[model samples]
Target: MLRVLSLLLVVQLCVAQQLEWPKQYTAKGQIILPYGDIVEPFTAYVDMSGKGRSRIDYYGGSAIVLNLGDEGQYGAMFKIVYETTQDFANVMTCFAVPGASGAPVTPQGVLPDISMYKYAADYMYNDVMSEIYISNNAEEEKNNNYTLLVRKDNKNPILFRFVGLDRLFGSHYDEYVIEYSDFETTVDATVFDYAKKFTCKGFPGPGLTLAMTENPMFEFVGAGEYEEKHRSYKVDSDFEEFKGHHSRQYDDEGEEAKRKTHFRHNHRYIHSMNRRDLPYKLRVNHLTDLADGEISRMRGYRHTPDSPRDTLYKPSISDVPEYYNWRLRGAVTPVKDQGICGSCWSFGTVGTLEGSQFIKNGMKNLKAFSEQSLMDCSWGYGNNGCDGGESERAYSWIMENGCIPTEESYGGGRYLMQDGFCNVNKSECGAKISMYMNTLPGNVTSLVMAIAERGPISVAIDASHKSFSFYSHGVYYEPACGNGADDLDHQVLAVGYGTLTPGDPDSEYWYIKNSWSTHWGNDGYVLMSRKNNNCGVATDASFAILN
Candidate 1:
């Protein structure tokens, strides 16, 4: 009994380190997703003025602003995404506009409930940091357990940790850790008031109605809807079209056999939410235009062989690390939206250059290379701009041109929908490529080594399937997804590689960076199964040598 009392005293002392929480304060911290292996740093501000408001800014050029007016009354929960080219932010709010009576938008529970946060003191410490476990069994909150790291001086927690096993994918444990920092009380009054001038749009994510404002944290706009309308809305005419297509397919197959065929071909894609979003018309368009099915369509090559490249270096006695992510190393760039254009090739090409530049000149000096420049300039080199292009040809042109301009300088940095004339102005150039090569097909080890040594590898995949469009998370592996080099339709960048469980063969996967924007997949990226040549990721990998 005496030892237990002494241990409690020691634990209390450990948690005595107080947080400096002023009446109005600001805190900065990084939110980490262990399963996705994504780390996003954010800064949040609180204003205790008239109604009480807070704003949180993500490092990925996005933000969330909330108005805590009265008890249970949320004035506005707004998400503002910064548009670098437009020089302004795009706003999506959860509060209804004044006079929107028929469309009474109550909080559909998008944001996490902080009402329980005050209960932190009631919990016992699990660690010396004053870490305590709390139940998120609240009616609105997603069913999960939370471990919070708290400070003595303030009621606010410094970190919120969530851990669970993936039920949809193979049974793999996932962890999400959000750590706060730079806690201060000072805040700007203007932050509390919503910015009405910004581009206001619908909240993103499934199940939320367009008529009602959605919780931006959990809600996301579908890619198909974005492609058709360029923004999120309550109305989903595109979704209706997809339903019609599915109905037609259902009718085409006899009812008895329909269920069995659907079950067999779609079980692999069952994990994807994208299939629900992809319409038949859009799928056809993606297949015809964006798919990179032309190995024969590719231009000049150093060696005629289409097989694997000869290994120059071999692994020694040292064991390869189980996990590696280029983003954590500051080698990769922030996610960028490809917009309506099928410019995945250009984005992938530029991503390789950006990663290589970080390796050579250090991350601080690295800048976003121009995909617009690649689209406008690399004409005769085999790319048809937004229509589609060859990664090898883009690399070859960069080598000859000597330098490529930064996205900001090249034609004002905005992604124009159509192809423009070659605008290779050396005076405005920001980066130069020395050389590049196509990785040997079917060589996972060599591809892994190349990404580890150099940086992101540009590659192609079979994105014609509906599952590819609405990918939310998890290692994507569809048996229906073709494995041939010609089956590769969409171009993406392989940024890193890791395993769900260290040294577990089934857990191996590659981290791919997509150009479809942050709302698309797990914040503009996807995990493809490693080693099995899943979805043709290892089929056609390419890397750039940067200056």
Candidate 2:
């Protein structure tokens, strides 16, 4: 009997050492994956009140904001998950029943209880170590070696570090850690309020749709308490705002209704995206109303295989700048619109040639090189003109012809939508390149070197997603971006690189100039997530070697 009593007492004492956290608190740190890889750093906001609410912004990566419903609400819950990078955020709001799919998208959207409360549950208090006094400074984490933590009140833990398995590691037996900080007691009520009350009007009700995102309009969605009253107010007000912003007028009432449906979709998506408070914003721009096929046709890039010599240049960059922009040096030309043409390759090709010429002449504007020259004349070299083409073929055509002509020298252009007869004078010469160099697949270091030390590099990226089309500002990044030749469908120039936050490697970005006009992006440029080549910025990138 005495032995049993002693064991019970010891267990109770062990449990007593647990750290009691506030109902609402926030933490920021890195997510070291179980496979010994560190993902983009993240800022997590967790609230365990009435219904648990949490928000996580993973640097320039994806973000998650969800609300766990209470019993009184009949287990109603809502979640919005975005597959994003620093450049752009692509969202999927499918709420299939929990066990329907094993993928991240299939996770139970509605749960019986607030799972966030489990962070401080009974089982998490084991081996809390001794109580120690420490100030809220950098020295504390190093002095204690992340063994234990005690906050200002000396009651609960301020520097709480949870080292656990990503299980995710499976047989490898690896572990990941979340060192939590910035503890608080009160959660901002306004955080998830808008989403919790969202009606998702003009769209289907939130349900388990057994597929990837079926529509782009539902990008920023969080299923709220199903209500009918919100329909009239939310949809009507948003429609008016959309009309005023874009100054739109319909031919008839039916057409207005149809446009309203698209407006509602984009309005809801834009609202949800802004609510995330991520660096980037999605605007109801010109591409917003365009059909999906139209948007796809706009991204014209025909993939060409890199020759053996292209693979020879391995990245050997030792030191790179924290920030660099070719635009600041006047190496970049003013943004031009591609219109409805699939001439992105020609634009990127011309951009690099123009930059090389500027650099070779010591920042002297020789002449504006003609993309139409490449579009019309490079057809025999396997370029499809405005229909679609590869930068490699265009470069080859330039090399074969020995030089490229200025826009005026080539008799201007035959508009962006079509190609004209090859009018190369054969003797025409403006911008010239001795040869071009290529960067290895996904080798971002070489990309930086080529851009900083040489000139702008023509790069291909997977920008087919609607999120990229509607991007207004902020670093564009999405995890779904692939680096394969087939995956890359849009051509752009990597003109510079920079960091949004110092000391954070994930905050780095690549400044890419696009040919989508000054009205698109931040005056026709996008800051792509750097370091990781998030959108295949380095894959098949070519630099003009001007003599």
Candidate 3:
């Protein structure tokens, strides 16, 4: 009886030792398959910030990064097979597929749960001995067990290895390993920062759907709750004062001020992520307005001398189906992120080319053309490089140059995010645009028909409102945003259109493809108010011709 009691006491002590584990550390190792192949070598950097917030990144694209917060939890996985380099972060900066689809097989259970194991060990590595443990089912998979090693002193797992038959494949035994090293009690705060670089098309999780403030304007209800919730976020002492200032200005100036107002201009009840930390001037609108001189320079149509103009031939199309998405048609291209560069012109230009080529040549031959070529080379023909640019100028450059290189070939498959000397090698060109047609300014019918017939149409819109910066979803319609041709500042692609209600014409909205990455909106697209040229979306619609 005494011997049995001693064993129980020892087991209790073992579990107690693992109660407080090292939350911030990095583990590096490789996976050895049954065939003795060492594959998917990786280094996982982890940050568990004690508030149920944790981020894990594996060196290779095999691991998916998890970003969780109170606002909206997002998680996605992608394997960047093409980019194999030392910089894992850059590889993660690319878009990831859904976790279910991504690899290294997202197990139902993760490593570090070592309670199921019964044995322990003191393994020697780098001339130092560390105590560890073992488990037959580290991930609770049938025919799977792991050798778990714990820190010599802390009792936290320092090395973990699962050796068992592959339950999922049922073909061979598998070996997974993780060796924790270079332990640190605390990590840099930036380690937990949600990177806008990596993204998924739609919201990984769900909450409130985005909507514009129209007749049924959303009323701010949780004022006290809003103020209390934001107190935790780092802000200046005068944040309350700033809120007060906007509140007074909004209430005092009557309806005119309300019409021309922004997010904080009327309501302070907003997601903390939506708040901008910029100075008042920069925050007034979400974007910088174009100079009058720049507008004048870009307004004129610059067509290729020998190219034929596109004649508008509309089919007497009836509103057939309740809803339509261009992605279903398979012509839409993979959304490209422009990074920090304001070269929306390049993205818009590239999107036009991708869609046109896919529509003309079919899906198998689709290619992602080079935006860098236009960014670096089109400066002489009126593009501003990283500063900003116009789509018309990009089209004109395409017409003159015959074509640009594929993104894979250009710059050796990387976006510089800065201007570089243009590579004018004709052999690198992957696709060519014969001509481009600009639709009548403020013509919704023409833009709709054009998109239905062709594919995505390059457009310029007024994305100056602060709400636009953090727009998630909805038919964004802000009448105060103005409806002038000159209001267009940001260039994007109109991939398709849809209706919220099946047969309601008033429910129509355009599906806008943005360059700000898939995490920004409904998987990198937005539904803007349709039929009225809301936000001046139809002000300048154009598409490429890949003949």
Candidate 4:
């Protein structure tokens, strides 16, 4: 079946060529596809000197000359292909370049290197689309027969097809893909003017893919290869209590009638969080405790203040046994404190919707959903104050009964009972969305990998450190005391992941993008320790797959 399809495709190519550019000829070096607009075209030039021989220059680069022979003996032929209207236009402008003396040269400064002697005849032949072929068949090479096979409708048209005399009798021709995009354009009548802006686009032609040959042009001793050596150790310690020893303090003093002032303070005990909170479960058991005299071997050991957590800790779609297909990824947006008003249910639901919508649309530009709608309409599902509620249940409610617009929505410390219709406009809210789920245990590496492979993930972590702020490339772990563990309760999104070391066994890191505003961490992002799988909060330990 595949072979039959391939043959039919080749036949179709021949028919398309007859429909687009029917006239064909041989040329030296390169060929240009002519478009009516001098602004765009598939163009190439040939360099026939030095050891580089037949180096064709098209777009911004050049391709090597595989076979160049005397004029008559059967010069080598190159095939060009076009697939779209854009592709047709690109080739047309290339053939329009006039003589050296012609004012307002063809393509009017669109192509940089417009040569007069090398560019043969400029005509339009119909095969598949309008195309132009240039060739150098001097009388000296009259016997030299070159066949330039041009195709109009093909999947990969940005390649050059080459057929040599050696394989002309029976051997099959090999295809070469060309990767050149920028060619020089000109305003004044000049052949080699390199000052003008050149509008460049890649050529989608047949056989352009196989023309690339690996070239090793430079050589240097001592600049080659080297082996790196390091030692390892194993340290036995409580991974949960492991914290770096460093501390600084600040003082706030003021009085209504007196001047207020802040003071600088210092301390030795640096409050550190348990490494286990990081995305990758750092195998501390195999690491040497620098704090202690334990000489434990370590593997990967790269560290960043803010990086994505590991994928191993992320929950897969399979994690949710019931909703095996409900896997999702997204971002988290902030919601104002409802004060005494119960609105978190709305925020949570909207947040989840935002993420799901983003995934559905396959776009990074996420739109906020109406939370006010949920607060006013989600009866029996949400509370009425700063109190919390189940986000999943809210989602279920909204999915069943639909939601309204934020413009018609109202809620805060107070609630106004009002009924509004569901407005399809998804831009009336302020909360962002992100994927939510739990990750597998001890799979910190896999979790980081997953997040990187997928988008971001939503997680619930022990943010006991209310004032979680990271600056520069350092994670200043400081706990905030507000609603305590309750206020300590908050949700955020994890955007990306990175590794501390290129090869450290424990070097895996998570590049987490957060929504606590740009003020928190690295512009609202945090690089939690991935080694101990700390980033994957307990709640996100599992996931659901939604195909």
In lDDT terms, which candidate is top?
A: 2
**Model 1 root mean square deviation, Cα atoms:** 20.0
- Write the residue-wise lDDT of candidate 4 on 1-547 in tens digits: 0011011111111212221211111122222211100111123332322211121223223211122222123322222211123122112111111112211111111111111112222222232331222222222212222222223333112212222222222321111112223322111223222212233233333221112111100000000111001000000112212222212111321121011000000000011111112221111111111211111010011112232222243333443111111123334444333222334344434544555455656655565556556544454544322333334444444444544334333343232322333333442343332323445544554555445444444444444331232132332222222321123244444444544445654544455543333433444456555544443332342222222
lDDT of 1 by residue, 1-547 (tens): 0011111222221323233334567667765544322355666666645545555555533444443443233344455543221232222323223213222223221113343322334334434345342434422222445555565435555666654433333332334566665566566766545555565554443332432122222222112112224222332333334345444344542332333322322221221122121111011111111122321222111111343332333323244555678888887889887766667788888888888887887655767888888888887677778777767778777778888778887877777756776667743777777666666677888678777777788888877655566466666776678767777767888989997656567658999998876756777888888757878888788886666
Model 2 global lDDT (CA atoms, 0 to 1): 0.59
Best by TM-score: 2
In candidate 1, how many Å is residue 349 off? 0.4
Candidate 3 pairs with clashing backbones: 132-149, 132-150, 133-148, 136-145, 201-523, 202-523, 286-464
Candidate 2, residues 429-526: lDDT per residue as tens digits? 77666677787678877777777777788899999766687788877777778877788999999889888877778768989999888767888888
Each prediction's RMSD over C-alphas, in Å, is 20.0, 17.6, 24.4, 28.1
Q: Model 4 reaches what TM-score against the true structure?
A: 0.32
Q: After superposing candidate 3, which stretches have Cα over 4 Å from the reference?
A: 1-269, 272-323
Return the TM-score for each candidate structure: 0.46, 0.57, 0.47, 0.32
What's model 1's TM-score? 0.46
Per-residue lDDT of candidate 3, residues 380-455 (tens digit): 6777777777777887787788886888887776777778878767337778777778777688877777777767
Q: Model 3 Cα displacement at 424 (Å)? A: 2.6
Looking at candidate 1, the ten consecutive residues that score lowest on lDDT are 277-286
Q: Could you tell me which 10 consecutive residues in candidate 3 have the lowest summed lDDT?
A: 214-223
Please report how far candidate 1 places residue 363 from its true position, in Å.
3.8
Q: Output the worst ten-in-a-row residue range by lDDT, candidate 4.
A: 260-269
